[model samples]
Target: MKGIVMEVYEDKVIVLAKDGSFLEVNRDNRDLDIGQEIEVDDNNKKIRGRIIKRLASIAAAFILLITTGYGVYGYYTPYGYINVDINPSVEIAYNLYNRVIDLKGLNEDGNILISKIKNYRNRTIENVINEVIDTAVEQAYVRPEQENVILITITEKKDKVDDEKIYKLVDSHIKQKIENTEVILIEGDNNIYKRAREDKISPGKLMLIEKAIDLNKDIKFEEVAKKPVKEIMRMIKEAKREKEKKEERKKLEKKTEKEMDKIEEMKFNKSRKAKGKKEDKLEREEIEKFRKDKTKKDEEEKEIEVDKIEKYKEKDQRRYLKKKSQDEFEEQRKEKQENLIINDNKKNQDNKYKVDKSEKKNKSKRGHENEYKHNKKERGKDED
Candidate 1:
């Protein structure tokens, strides 16, 4: 019969016939592949019951593999951790669903305490922690009459988890369950837990040791690790008070310095103002002195001008006097010459009058002599 190979096995091959029925045939040494057409003998055909049985076996194996993978993933993966320290240090590890997946003891006392508690399977983390504390109390690891300190450090591996809420819830629950016990809750991270594991101590104990060292630099990590939590808290308080006092002193000194600087600035401004006033006074004095000198010089120049004018007037007066004297002398000389000319004219007139009178008397004497001659001549003619 001709058929198409569907599955190949070591001893047999499953094939689909053209008639739409499945057949199981014994495999030969020849290479046969799935989906390849081939010829098989009708005698080699097996019953369909064997194919059903083989398919059922494969289905059962696949289901088992899936279930086992899920189981390992859920049980082995850690989501968060809680470190409980009370002298008996126990670290509990939980899965994503908040179920306790693992529990470990960090010390000998922790190991002993963990051995006493049984059946951690399927228990919630809160129940596991409460049981651990109750077991510790029963074992005399935590005493009620004395001072008991319980430190819980929580570290989360996922961001979606609310670490603060978990811390508050755990703190509130443990405080209610135990009486007269001091409970300290710390929210921690992966790095603190890793370092705690390396140091072979619980995370809560490691945190207290670190804080003690910060408060007192002289205290070594080994020394703090051996000390109790109460002593470390006391050292931190004292150191903080000292630091606050030093800061106050520094602030006071700064305030005093600022006041002194302000006073010096005011003094400098006052001195500068006084110097400016003195300079103004000197400038005014110099200006006044210059004005007085100018006025005195102008008066001296006026006096010199007045003296020059007086000298000019005196010279003109002398010249006028000399001209008047010369005019008077010329008038007197002209009057004297006119009087001399009048006297000479009067003398000449008088001489001329005396000569005329003499002439007239002579003429009369001549007339009488002539008349006597005529009379004598007539008397001589009469005698002849």
Candidate 2:
């Protein structure tokens, strides 16, 4: 039965099943959390099961231990060199406390391998090496169930570590963690290391290349060395597929960028056309306004000219009327003078006639008087 651990106690664990039933399993607390998954061991009547964690951790600690107490006798427990050659080479040295004391890279490929397993230092060398192999297998550095050659050499004193102890610790661990790989152990003279230095390749890589050459006599080490480990492992087929995929992805991205640029250009052209239209409209309105103002000014000027002409006509008419009145007045005055002159002449004639009549009367009287005086003179002379 599989269940989630609800609680952990000193001697038991309470697990919650999927059916909402609580089960108390009588087992030692293995640092299990409340939500840890566990399987019930069917063989044991005591409801005991393994607590499964992540796949990586499970692969790292695949070995089942016989003894329970995790103990080290001293602080300076030294486990000598463990040289691993998978085409990459690595040599790891551990102290009694399971911490890494020194590491050596046999070649360029081995350099980064040390960094991969460096964190496992100061821990148990068994589980640490298990983690290294498991991680390497997952990363495709080592192909399990394939023809990869591995050579392991451990050198230590009898008191510190023995052959059987080292063999039991590493041999089964590698076998259980990795599969189908030829493992070679060297106690005295390591010609593999000498061969690696001469070839300028790691011992692990040299082993693999020689193994491949053994299968095909026509293949040369120089030709195989030109290819990387992953390419060599895939035999050149997968590498071609990966390259093609990368090229396809790049082409798709370039096409997408081109489409986006075209869209932006179209938008910019649209905006430019809009702005041009707006400017043209404003220019047209300005032209209309200017024409209207010009027409208005012309009309006003025409009105002003018409008013001036009307005023001039009125002034001319007034002047003409004044001149005619003056001429009429002068003609009346001349007529009046002529009439007065005629009247004066007639009065003078009458006066002359009256004076003449008076004179005539006087003369007639004088004549009569003269006649009477002649008669009186005749009478007086007769009387004398």
Candidate 3:
């Protein structure tokens, strides 16, 4: 049956079928993504029944191919491949049923290790891997006292299986069976596997070499390709550490630069405030000086005005005294003149009175004589 992959998990894929039904199928190294179309076995039967049917079909195909004289070739045909690298490089091929079909050595140490394994064919892939590790341990290829690294790279001929399950099974088995060994698992495509084979190296080693070269561009592939897996991994680890340290240093430098910039800004603002204060002080001093000068000028003007008033008062007093003295002298001269006139007039009148008195006395004397003569004549006449 065909369906669209709706969701994918480590060991199962949720597929949406055309009949609007959902099916959960076991994922065995199948590289599936959401929305991709895939062929799945019918879900009507139980998973055990399906496996039995599949096995029956294989058996029938095997019998048919045996009658055709091509049974061994068809049974040994690989559906997936795994490359194990420790210093020794070994490759294992498995058929559709996940049974090991072949094993090959890529180097001298790998050849020696494989020669020690008595029987690997027709065994489960996990059992085959266990035996291979056991053989390597027996040959001292994997020493517990030293830093042992095993790099496993898996590549499928078709997208019908989940490599993650296989990697987990192998990882769990090796960890239980071995100690003090680092196991690295890699899931690769046909292109990378083919390229690694062409370069005469395992895919896991090639991947490490590529990563190392990316970290340090000065490293050459040929120079590092011949090195052991442990040494290449060590180089990769040191390079990563150096990269991290450099990043941290750059961050610290940036932080220091920012702090310095902040300090400089504060200093600039402080200096600006100080300069402003100095200008303010100078301005205040100028204002105070102007006030003092104005005060002094006003005092000097008042003193000059007072002196002018005093000088005017003195001139007025002198003029008043001179005028009074002149008036007094004129009055005294006029009084003396009046007194002399009165005295002259009195003298003249006194002289006139004396003359009149003398004349009057003479007249009186003549009149009395005349009266007496007349009386005497009258008396004589009477006597006669």
Candidate 4:
């Protein structure tokens, strides 16, 4: 006889059927309760026919399970989703059924419905389950296999962002520019993005963009940049150099003007000296002409004196160091003229022919000496 029966264990029933069976089951969570009667079939009542064999059935089921888990890549057409096991890293379970359905290529209405559910992320496992139920309510019921339901769902929760830590870091960056930088950059939990639990765009990236828009949107970066002490000193030195260059340029201009003035003054003095020399030459020529024009001559005596006078006139004027000034020279000349006053001891007219060559015509005997000739003539007549 062949037999089929159910025995309860752990609030669930397990079915066993036996007919010449092997009960060497390796792995199954079906432990039979002791002293429970199982349906049996016997032909001779000596255990030779058939009996309930739960172990054999469990062994067969286990062989099928491992084979399915390692199944090769293929199109999976699922009439309904039963139990599903998720990777531990996938924290959001609301996306589980939709991902599987999309991979399977479901209908249009089904796709949209799944998408809405996946968009709703729940922080906890219970919330995720509720969300999945809600998704089912939204979709019109098309009855599915009773055994096809979620079994195992693993999740990785995102780490909560510590606002305090973020605030400190932001303040640190801001404090570099402003004396009192305590403005908040991140507002709440949305700023915290967990990579393992979710693949989301980094929220902190928008911090710079947000800062671009503000009440006073004057973002100055130079103030934040730190200047090295050496660099600052270098700038100061450069500024000083520029100032010195300006001052030096002014000084050079002044110096050039002074040099120009000196040149002009020297030219003026040279011109004046040239004019003085020309005037002095003209005056000396006029004095010599005046004295020559006033000259007189004696008829025969004058002829003899003319050769001597011509010789004296052609000779260079004697350059004698003045024994004294013009006043002294004039006084001396007057005394000498008075002594030559046709003295009663007049020796020159006494022996004119015997006069020595040096005394021959020591003074003028022509026009300039006519005044002397009149004295001599008067004295000679008196002697006659």
Clashing pairs in 2: 77-95, 77-96, 87-204, 87-205, 98-122, 98-123, 99-122
Q: Rate the local accuracy (lDDT) of all candidates.
A: 0.74, 0.62, 0.79, 0.38
Q: Tens-digit lDDT track for model 1 on 1-384?
A: 776566779988876666655678877664455544567666756546666676445444533542586755755578888888887789998876676778889888889999987656445676677788888888987775777777788888766446567566666765675677777877788888889888888777888888766766787876666555555555666776766777888897898899889989999878767778687788789899999999999999999999899999889889988888888888888888888888788778777877887888888889899999999999999999
Please give each candidate's TM-score: 0.45, 0.31, 0.54, 0.15
Looking at candidate 1, what is the lDDT of residue 165?
70
TM-score, cand. 4: 0.15
Clashes of each: 0, 7, 7, 7
Clashing pairs in 1: none
Residues 184-255, candidate 2: write the lDDT tens digits.
654522566467658765544555566666655566788887554443545434545666788999999999
Worst 10 residues of 3 by lDDT: 43-52
Best by TM-score: 3
The TM-score-based order of candidates, best leading, equals: 3, 1, 2, 4
- Give lDDT for model 2: 0.62
Give me the displacement of residue 7 in model 2, in angstroms: 21
| Model 3, C-alpha of 263: deviation from truth (Å) | 1.4
Q: Pick the candidate with the highest lDDT.
A: 3
After superposition, the stretches of candidate 1 with alpha carbons farther than 4 Å from their true spots are: 1-67, 177-179, 245-384
RMSD to the hidden true structure, all candidates:
30.1, 29.8, 26.6, 35.3
TM value for model 2? 0.31
